[model samples]
Target: MRIDAAIDAFVRQLTVDRGLSEQTARAYRGDLVDLAAFAEEAGVTEAEAIDLELLRDWQWHVSDRLAKSSLARRTAAVRGFTAWLARTGAAAGDAGARLRAPKSDKHLPRVLDRSQLDVLFARLEGRAAGDDPVAIRDLAIVELLYASAIRVSELVGLELGDVDRTRLMVRVLGKGGKERVVPFGVPAARALDRYLGAGRPALLRDGIDALLLDTLFLGARGAPLTARTVYQLVASLLADLPGSGPAGPHTFRHTAATHLLDGGADLRAVQELLGHASLATTQIYTHVSAERLKAAYATAHPRA
Candidate 1:
């Protein structure tokens, strides 16, 4: 089979059979496409022509240009693709079974301190105190993001029925199509109430279709809210802060998780709240909490 056709089949299987998200499938497609181009350059365009040496050469070709993390992801992508090709009999063998890449560099996720969060919310609250619908919606978005620790994708994908205002819970469809209920605080509930009662209605245009009406959050023109919009909103808020890491919506998630741990929330409970499939994935927040404690002890200790 041709490499390109084989890659398409692999990506289709990733999304359809493995239930991977579109974003994940896209990443796999991108990596495999690059590999296909590389293989073509080597006069090895056929899927069966690919071997462990070709895979290693391709990794070496891109090693200098990509960071270890991106290289790791690309390596994993190709490994999966080759494994799929072998499993489905599209290739003679798995070319990437022996492929390896350097481990990704681990950095503690950026987390906002309590004072920083207070400053952020104060500004948001000031903006929301007015009658501006966009400002109101923005407040609600930030509040819910920090309160629920949900992914921005899950947040924008939320629908009207997904939220339970009476119980302060939200149902989110997480990665791999897993559904989980997360609880928010009273502040988030109040902000959501204000948005639902006034902001959303004001933003909704007349003659809108019923599908958009079911969306939990809407754009300025009554369309469903997008992940990019949420990213910009959170980025702008985090830009003025003293931190020096990523300023996207995931920062809110990290901050929320770290704060939960700092306040004595159980590790397993937080894992469930964050919709993490594995406790190991959620343990990073414990590291963040410990780092914070170490910073405090180092700064305030009398004998240091």
Candidate 2:
């Protein structure tokens, strides 16, 4: 069998039997695709034919140029692939058993300050109130993203029936098909109300009740907004703002979570709101909150 086809089957097994997240499965497939391409060029076809020296050399070639995190993730893919080969009796032993990922740099997430958020929100409101339905839809998209701290996929996948405005909560289908209810503040609710009432109707070319119809923010053709479009919106907003960091839809989530913690929201509460399966995932915002507090104290307090 071709290595690409074999790697595809292996990744499918990881998804169905091992219950890995789709993102993880996709990453594994990407790493293995690169490996398969290289092996095919070198005339190595079978998993058993992959020796430690070849594995080491491939990793060395990749590590020399790729970022440490990228190299680390690719290394993990190698280890996982080799382990799978051994488990399935395709190989005598794990060829990459001793392979190591490079240490990754722990860069803090970029966050917009409260004032910046205020400015962005103001701009969003103005845009939404304009004579365009797309702008109105974009208002709701921005509001929900910042308000919920959900992944972009989750946000775009949202349907009208999924939101329970009566309870001020949204039912989200998170990673692993896990369902969770995430709450947002009143402001988000208002923006959503505006979109549903006024904006969405203007964009309806078909009978769809999706809360964010066609896409929350539609293009000139009146189709739903793509994740890339949402990312560009966030990036554009960050560019207008003063501080510099990795700006994307995710940055809004990090900022929202950190700000909630800074305002003394309980850690567990933040965890649930973010739909994190582990408290550890939510705890990163706690560190962000603490860092902000330290910075504030250093600037404001003179008691040193």
Candidate 3:
């Protein structure tokens, strides 16, 4: 089979059978497409022609151009593709079974301190106090993001029915199509109430369709909110802050999880709250909490 055709089949199986998210499947496809181009350059366009040597050569060619984490992801992508091809009888053997990439460097995710969070919320609240619908919506977006610790994709994917205002709970469809309920604080509930009651109505255009009406958050043009817009909203909000890492919505997620741990929330409970598939994925916050504690001890300790 052709490498491109094999990659398409593999991605389809990933999404349809394995239940991977569209974003993940797209990443797999992109990595495989790059591999296919490389294979073509080496006169090995057929899936059956792939070999360990060819895979290693391709990795060497791209090693200097890509970051370690991206290289790791590409290696995993190709390994999955080759394994699938072998299992489906499209290839002679799994060419990437022995392929390896360097482990990605682990940097603790950027987390905001309580004072920083307070300043951020105060700014948002000041803007929301005015009658501007977009400002109100922005306030609600940041509030719910920090309160619920949801992925930006999950946040924007929410529908109107997904939230239970009375209970202060939200139902989110997480990675691998898993659905979980997450609770938010009263502050988030109040912000959501304001957005739903006033902000959303003002943003909705006349003669809107039913699908958009069901969407929980709307853009300035009354369309469903997108992940890019959410990122921009968060980036602009965090630009003037004193921190030194990414200023996207995931920073809110990391901050929320770290704060939860710092306040003595159970590890397993936080895992479920964040809709993590594994407890190991949630343990990173514990490291963040410990680092914060060490920092506090170093600054306040009087003894040498």
Listed per model in order, the count of residue pairs whose N, CA or C atoms clash below 3 Å is 0, 3, 0
What is the C-alpha local distance difference test score of candidate 1?
0.93
TM-score of each model, in listed order: 0.97, 0.90, 0.98
Report RMSD for candidate 2.
2.7
Query: Root-mean-square deviation of each candidate, in angstroms?
Result: 1.1, 2.7, 1.0
Whole-model lDDT, candidate 3? 0.94
lDDT of 3 by residue, 220-263 (tens): 99999999999999999899999787889999999999999999
Q: Between the candidate structures 1 and 2, which one is better when assessed by lDDT?
A: 1
The pairs that clash in candidate 1 are: none
What's the TM for model 3? Answer: 0.98
Tens-place lDDT digits, model 2, residues 1-304: 4566668879999899878767779989999988877776678888788878778878887777899989988888888888888888787888889888779987777888989989998988887777687787787888889888888878876777788899989888787777888888799899888878887777776755455453444544556657788888888877878876778899888998988888888999988888788999888887777777888899999983
Candidate no. 1 TM-score: 0.97
Residue pairs in collision within model 2? 160-211, 214-224, 215-224
State the lDDT at 204 in candidate 3.
97
